[model samples]
Target chain A: MQQRDNENRLSQEYTNSVLLNGTLQTPKWWPYLVSILGFFVVIGFVLFGIQIKYGLGVTGLNRPIYWGLYITTFVFWVGISHAGIMISAILRLTQAEWRRPVTRAAEILTIFSLATALVFPLIHAGRTWRIVYWLIPYDASRGIWPNIRSPLFMDPIAISTYLTGSTLFLFVALLPDLAVLRDRTTGFRKGFYTILALGWRGNPRQWKMQVVGGILLSALMLPIFVSVHSIVSWDFAVTTAVEGWHSTIFAPYFVIGAVHSGVSAVVTMMALMRWGWGWNEFIRPEHFDALARLLTVVATAWLGFTFLELLFALYGLDAPEIALREMQIFQYPWNMLFLTFLLTGYILPVPMWIFKRIRTNIALMFWSSILVNIGMWLERFLIIVPGLARRTPFVFTWEAYSPSWFEWYILFWSFCWVTLLMLIFSRVFPLVPLFEQKESEVFSDDIKIGRATVPTIFREEEE
Target chain B: MVAEKNRSWGMVIDTDKCNGCSGCVTACQVENNIPLNDQNKFERGRVMSWIRIERYWEGEFPNVKARFIPIMCQHCENAPCEPVCPVYATYHNNEGLNVQVYNRCVGTRYCANGCPYIVRMFNYWEPTWPEEIRNHLNPDVTIRSRGIMEKCSMCMQRIKRGERNAGDQLQDGEIKTACQEACTTGAITFGDLNDPESEVSILAKSDRKYSLMPQLNTNPNVVYLATVDPYKDKNLGEKAKTNEH
Candidate 1:
């Protein structure tokens, strides 16, 4: 009975520390960052407006190289969305106690990153206003239904399903925490939390149902996250007339790439949250270590897939593929750029992650994670542009593609948009999942093993 | 049958006779109201011609072999551009021409990127015609606005005009694309491939007649005759003698 009381006190202390941290006053830089983000967002909006007024000609997109930075960045952001929900769901399923503090940031990142990613396709569209034409069911009178066979059509269906699933999963997890905030807060905050809490008073039934709903949503979302990226890859892969894009292995290749970049994004976000908010006690080096290990595996797998794809294309010597592979190796700018992608995405990071010290080092892990994303972005660029440039087997007609400054600006603001949205999201909600974090405490016990005290997790069910 | 009325339009380009005058390119641009391609357009990889002529150099300068080949939309029986269009902006028509529905295009440009031929062009700029040029514009064709892809329709508008003028059916040699009409050396022949008597159908049977990128089996309607070489026999004779020795 005394042991139970002491445990309760420990849980209370943990809860108070996390909850009180959530209601921290907005930092001074918050407004400055938002304003800066606003300035750039307005600039993007202005550029888009001029683009609409003048046509896509305002951008450097032209013949033979029609899809450029817009499509590449679009794919990158969408791939990043895969990181959050997949990590949260898999870790939750495995009953990883360390996953508790990380889940909200990851899930919220997935939702907003997806929201940001969807905007690119619309922006990339030639007839932006008529984008709705694709969504409306094909009418027989018009002799068209949105081409069900097209991967572009599949994008909307997959992303929306994913967006909906992740949003619900996030809300379900937020409810109990919202109720806690409801009890502690007052005035406008109290009412806001009360309504969002959906009349929860920490009753046994509410917890039971919330747990059941979270499990169901997590189960539903894992496959969806997988399929969302696969569908995005098919948008390129099934454009099989292009050489680098014509591989059969693209779906799995892309799914792995998405997780790789996504985990990097998660690690970067976690590092930012940990130090920036002084929540180091809650989000420890162990989480970064775990993420780094996952990243190493993902990066190795990415390298393996890239090697297999290169070998298969080389073996077949299909004319378009042959020409592109030659360019990938021997061509001046692409050769150097491709090497950069290899170094950043795999070669450099893999060796660093093998050492426990480097993996646990927050700064090194953070930068490497950022580097992986940059390399992944380059990977997307190499996939779309070079393949499109050497589009045909006829050597004389082959063209080279490079993005214009116009495209670079849109891409620049897209990152800002993601960061800006994340910043705003911080103000409204706590970065850590208070309910899950507290519940996670119930499982840990420091058991003496050999010569040392080792922290261990206890599970009621093996699953 | 409805298919019978749908003529399978085909073209025969005799590369042997091509003088590389670029007449066909100019004619197509003029006839279709293509925007004036500036130096910047070429630098930016934005050349907008529906049919472009490619030049190949076979040897070093002193003993060089130069070959000129014109490429346009293949109008394949199994068109890669058709199924990839989410809005059905581009599709194979009853007349066996791959048509672009300009109004329907939302500018995804997947069709342009999907095409192995790289023949499709997008409207990066809203087309503007000078007053005098606007007067000469082909009234039968729609001036495509920004964000939509446009490409060779195999002179579908001219074919429609020819059929409409000819009362019922177009005579074998009556219809001509702008490119065919402008080729001074008679290098281009446009006709119905379904009609065995048509020149394209006859030329298609020749051993020398081959489509661009035939390995893809896109089954292009446009066929090309190999550019003949005067030194062919001498080169072969030397190679054969070497093998015998």
Candidate 2:
């Protein structure tokens, strides 16, 4: 028993050293990678500055096609943020043990992606400086309350609420880890972790409170998780003026699409985490296998929603709706994008994901997950731009949108910005939660039946 | 100041009389201080004309006849653009005008997306005028800065001025919108629809009158008198099939 305890302690020490490497001891490539991402992020901010100084004209926006790439990327990032709630909150409620290693990275992705998503509307606006009037209720003294009736108003409210909740959820899960960092570090790092740790002592009472807080937050956040994407979908769905936009299916369609893309993004992040940190033991093929199985189910459901949306769109047999769908599907460029969206969004990756070999292959999962995002981004683009570009009663205004290079650069910048934030976050916190890792180690056991031994995870029964 | 009066302002366009001259388009641009729609603007699909004359071909190219309909902000009673504006920059005013408060507009362009007529135009760039033509700009209208939405106020400046001139008992013919004033064929008529004696009110009651995209139920104040097509009956079957879709 004493020998077993020593072996367990040595294993825990190895786990701590490996997970805490970034915070405790810096990696050689960390600074270089951060600088490169930071350089691009700064350049993106400058380009945005130039865009603001000139006008929205710098982008490809026109009279009819008022929204383009910015809005598309906006919805894309919002969709990407569904990773956190899906992995941490939903899986926790369902008592999924494999969620232990990935919860932090997924939650961090949510926070950063959401922060990035919130910026698109302001920058996409004609008057970015004056967006405060739309955002704030400060003008109520003039008897003009910000139009609560506006979906635009609801968007900010819903998004900010989710951001706040996610941040709290992240921080709650982070407390024990922060306390660990505090004990291990010195000087400024120690001070930083000390304040953030909130006097977490690993006492029984504190652990109980932490667990209760996490569970409570997860339960509370489930509604917000559903509402955030639903509201985002409503922004497009409620607009009756756009041919393909006014749909009842948008809410469920967007939510499911978000999960498909978001989970894929998490898979992509997990593959990168495994490779980049060399955490082979922690984030294993089994984890990827579990995520792939979940994704196969998610991607299929999303495909169903996609077809259902199309079916309902065509159900009315409305001439304009048919014309829009035709241009979206049969026309030269849009048809190509539609094909690519279908291939990458579901057909290619989902089929590959069905096979256990591909599901367990890290390299294949990474590339496939990246493809899913590209397809998801195209899906949003296809929805937004085509609806605007559709033939109205006035043929004179029929025109196609081509995103400007500046818009493309800005889109590129958002990716870099999110990545930079993630890298910075990793430098401070373990991407994989340490406490959860230890818990998993403690909970893991092997049982023998006759000559066969099988691995199992067990938790203590609640009193 | 004009005494506040309950007036439902409206417009009636006689498509039969319109020669597709584009006089109203140019007149509205000048009157509203709309940015010069240069070739670059046209190519980019960002032209800022407050009103446009859409010409539709009625038949095969050999026997084709052009039908012109001047379209503008319908100033709908149930304006889709109004409620969607987060800043309340666009709203229905007491004078029955669909008012677009320029300064209040932060230009989310949500209102533009909501407008089925697609009348709302965003100032994609700051409005500029050559030094020689700078004085020609109408000082009565505010020069909309880049990044805000502007649309046909139905020449609200003129309506306010007309009301201020006429005081308590404003006459129907007193307010002539820029489009009406410039229309050489008497195609465009503007007046208070509340007055039964108004020319617009009488024209709006005509059997040929219709509103654009009536299925959307915008309930527009701008009424159009359908073109008196001589060949309409000859192609009735084709037209019916087209309408059925």
Candidate 3:
């Protein structure tokens, strides 16, 4: 019994050292990676500066095609932001065991991607500087409150609420981990973790409170998660003038699509984390297998929504609506894009994911997840642009949209910015939740029934 | 002079009388201080015309008949662009005019997207004019800057001036919009819909009267009279000859 306890303690110490690699001991390549990502982020800000100074004319936006890549990328990032809540909150409530290792990384992706998503609306506006007026009520002075009916107004409110809630959820989950770092490190880092730990001593009461806080936040954030993407969809959906955009299916379509992309993004992050940190022991093939199964279901549901959107659009049988559909599906460049969107978004990644072998392969999983995002982004692009480009009865006003190189750079910049923030975050905190990993170890056990051994998870009873 | 109570500003456009001269389009640009739309702007699909003459060919080859209709802001009573604007920059006024407040506009282009007529125009760059023609800009109108939406205000400055000039009452013909005044064939008439005796009110009751895209139920103040095409009905031309005989 003494020898067995010693072996368990040694393994526990080994797990702690591996999980806390970034916080306790910085990696050799950390500085180099940060600097490289930092360079790209700086260039992105500079490009934004140029866009502001030169006016929105720098983009390929025109009279009829007022929104282009900016709006598409905005929706994509917001969709990507859905991963955290879907994994950490929804899965937690459902009591999914595999969610433990990925919960933190997914939540971090949610907060950072959401923050990036909020930036696009402001920058895409004609007057970026004047966007500050959107936050406050001007009722006392001008008797003009921001139009509560406007979906654009609702977007910021929903997004900011989600961001705040996600940040709090992240901080709450980080407390015990912070205490771990606080005890392990010295100097500025120790002080940093100490302030954040809030004197979490890991007593029975603190643990109970922490667990309860997480559960309550998970419940609160669920509605916000749904509302954020729904509001984003309404930004386009409420416009009756845009033929393809004004659809009742948009809210659910957007939410499901967001989940599909968001969860895939988490999978991509997990693959990278495993490869980069050499955490093969923690983020095993089983985790990828579980996420892949979740993704297959999500991607399939997303496909059903896509089909429904297209079906109902044709069901109207309106001349303009038909013409718009014809142009979106049959037209030259749009047809190509439509095909690409299908191939990348659903047709390609989903079938590969159905096979157990492909799900367990990290390299294949990474590339397929990346392909899913490419498809999702193209899906948003196809939805936004082709609708705008649809030729109206006023034939003179019909125009095509081609995103400028500047716009492409901005899109690229957004990725760099998100990655940089995530990297910086990883330096301070463990990407995988340490306590959850330890708890999972305790809960997982093998039972031998006759000659067969079955793996099972056992949960502690709540008092 | 008696002040008309609950006056509703409106227009009656006779499409048959419009010859596709595009005079109103030019006049509007001058009167509203619209930025010069050069060849480059046209190429970029950023032309800033407040009023445009849309020409549609009726038939093929020898039977072809060009139909001309001058299109501008319909000024719908239930404007789709109004509610979508986060800043409340555009709204319907008591005078039955769709008003766009320039200073309040943050230019999300959501209003432009909401407008079915494609009348709203966004200023992609600062309004500029060559030094030679700089003095020709209208002093009464505000020159809209870059990164904001601008559209046909129905020449609100002219309406205000016409109201101010009239001591107690405004006449039917007094508040002539820039497009109405410049129309050589008197195709466009501006008047108060509230006054039962007004020409526009009478025209609005005509058999040929219709609003653009009525299916959308916008209930626009600007009514158009469909062109009386004799070629549309072969019997109509024969009936005219027989009646003359």
Candidate 4:
């Protein structure tokens, strides 16, 4: 009884400290970082405005490379969004306790990254004003139905569904935490959390419903997350003329690839939060150890899928396919980037991640995650550009495309946009779920081993 | 109705007669109001040529050979560019022309990528016409706006004008495309394939006729007559005689 009382006190103290972070004064660098990112975000918008006013010629998109860095960035961010549900939903559903501290930060990652991605279709459109024609369901004015067959139509539908579903999931899980803040704080802060809390008094039924609702939402969103990236891949896959794009394997290849990058991004984000916010105790190295093991398996699968695509290309021996492969190897101006993608994405990470020491090192996890995402960005570029370079059999029209300043600026600025929104969001919301964190510590007990006590998770098991 | 179903507008290019000339390219620019490509645009691969003449150099130094082929929109029956269009901006029309709806295009450029012919061109900038050149712009065809995808229409404006002028029925040789009109060597032939009596139908059936990248199964309307080589013929003749013997 005395030890149990001590355990309850320990859990209570940990909960209070975590909860107090939400009420802490805004950090010094917060506004400064926001301002700088906000400035660049403005610049991105201005550049897009210029492109819209002057036409796509302002960017270096020529005849064949109709989709350029804009599309690559779009796919990258959408792929980043998959990280949230994969880490939060799948792990939570499996009852993994490591997800507790990371859940809120990861789910918001989905919201902001997806928000950033949604801007690209508008930015890259040839006629920005006429994009509305695609949104209008009825075809009466346009004289033809928006082609239901096109993967372009599926993107908006699937993305919006996932976004709305995930947002509701985030808010519903957030209520009990908000209720805690409401009871403890005063002034405008009290009123704000109170209304958002929706009058929850930590009632048993409300908690029960919140838990069940979260699981149901997670169940609903899993397929949505998978299909979203698959449909994004189809935008390239259905176009038979672009040699490397029309692939039978693209759908699964894209989904698994997305999962790899998304999980790696979560690891990178957790490492950043550990250092930047000094949340070391909460986001421990042990969390990254588990994540790195997952990353190694995912990277191995990705490597297999990538090489399978290459083998299929070689098998066809089709002229366009051969030409595209040759260009990727020898002719791409950014050949060094491809080499780096192969090294960091598959070659280096695979071997390094196999060792538990490298996986457990926080600094290595940080650097490796960043390298993996960079490799992923290049992978998206390799998938898009080379296919268009050797687009047709006509030798005269076969031309190379290099992204101009506008593309680079927009891509960099989009990163800023995502970072800025996440920073601003961090200031207002609870980064870690107070309720779940306390519950995890309360449920777990140390079991007596031969020489040491190991944590034995005492909870419901799969029947 | 069956007769209408059999009607396929097609083109035949006799590569044997085509000299390495830029007249057809020039005439296409003038007639279609395609913007004059500056050096910067050409360097950037933004050239707006609707129909272009491609020159291929076959051999080194002494036996140097340059082959000129006039390439344009093939208007394929199963066009790779068609179904991929989200807005249906480009599709095969009833008359066999692969029509591009300039106004309808949101400029995703999927059609440009899906085109194996590399024939589809995008307007990078709103095409600027010098004041004097503006006055001479063809009134029959729309000057495509910037941010729209455009390509050779097979002179659809002329096809319509000729059909309208011909009243109830169309006549053979009554209509011709700008490229055909500008080809001084009589290399380009355009006609209705449904009319088996037409010149294009006869040439399309020729032993040497072939479509570009026929293995892709695009069923392109533009058929090419392989260029006849005198030096290669002697080698082929000796091989054929040996096989017979």
**Top-TM-score structure, candidate number:** 2
What is the per-residue lDDT of model 3 for residues A1-463, given as tens digits with 9 covering 90 to 100? Answer: 1312332332566778888887677788888999999999999999898878878888888979988999999999999999999999999999999999999999999999999999999779888888877756567546779999999999888999999999999999998989998999889878888999999999999999999999999999989877999999998998888899999999999999999999999999999998889898889999999999999999999999999999999998999999999999898999999999999999999999989999999999999999999999999999999888889889788787878899999999999999999999998899989999888877887788999977789887989
After superposition, the stretches of candidate 2 with alpha carbons farther than 4 Å from their true spots are A1-10, A140-143, B1-4, B232-245
Residue A444's lDDT within candidate 3 is 80
Of 2 and 4, the candidate ahead on lDDT is 2
lDDT per residue (tens digit) for residues B56-122 in model 4: 7765566667778889999999998888788889988888878998888998887888888889898
Q: Any runs in candidate 4 off by more than 4 Å, and if so which?
A: A1-5, A19-24, A185-191, A331-334, A460-463, B1-6, B235-245
lDDT for model 3 = 0.89
Q: Summarize candidate 4's per-residue lDDT along A1-463 as a digit string, tens digits.
A: 1322554334565555654563455766777888999999999888888999999988878877788899999999989998888877898888888788888888988888888787788788889889888866578786778888888877877787878988998998899878877877789988999899888987789888889999999998889867999999999998877788989899889988988898888988888787667767667777888888888888899899999988988897777688778778766475776798898788877688888899889998899898899999899998998877764646778677778998999999988998888887777777777777777777777878999978767887779
Which of the predicted structures, 1 or 3, would earn the higher lDDT when compared with the native?
A: 3
What interface RMSD does each of the candidate structures achieve?
1.5, 0.8, 0.8, 1.1
Off by over 4 Å in 1: A1-10, A20-24, A136-143, A391-396, B1-4, B60-62, B236-245
Chain A TM-scores, candidates in order = 0.94, 0.97, 0.97, 0.95
lDDT tens string, model 3, B1-245? Answer: 32335778899999879999999999999999998889988888898998988887766567667778899999998888998999888998888889999888887999998888999999988889999779988999999988899999989999888888995677788788999889999999999888899999999888788788877778888998877767756533432232221
Using DockQ as the measure, the top candidate is 2
Docking class of 3: medium
Docking quality level of the chain pair in candidate 2: high
Candidate 1, CAPRI quality class derived from DockQ: medium
Residue range A369-400, candidate 2, lDDT tens digits: 99999999999999999999889989777778
Model 1 lDDT per residue over A199-298, tens place:
9878899889999998888888878867998999888887758888888888888888999999899999989887777777678898888888878888
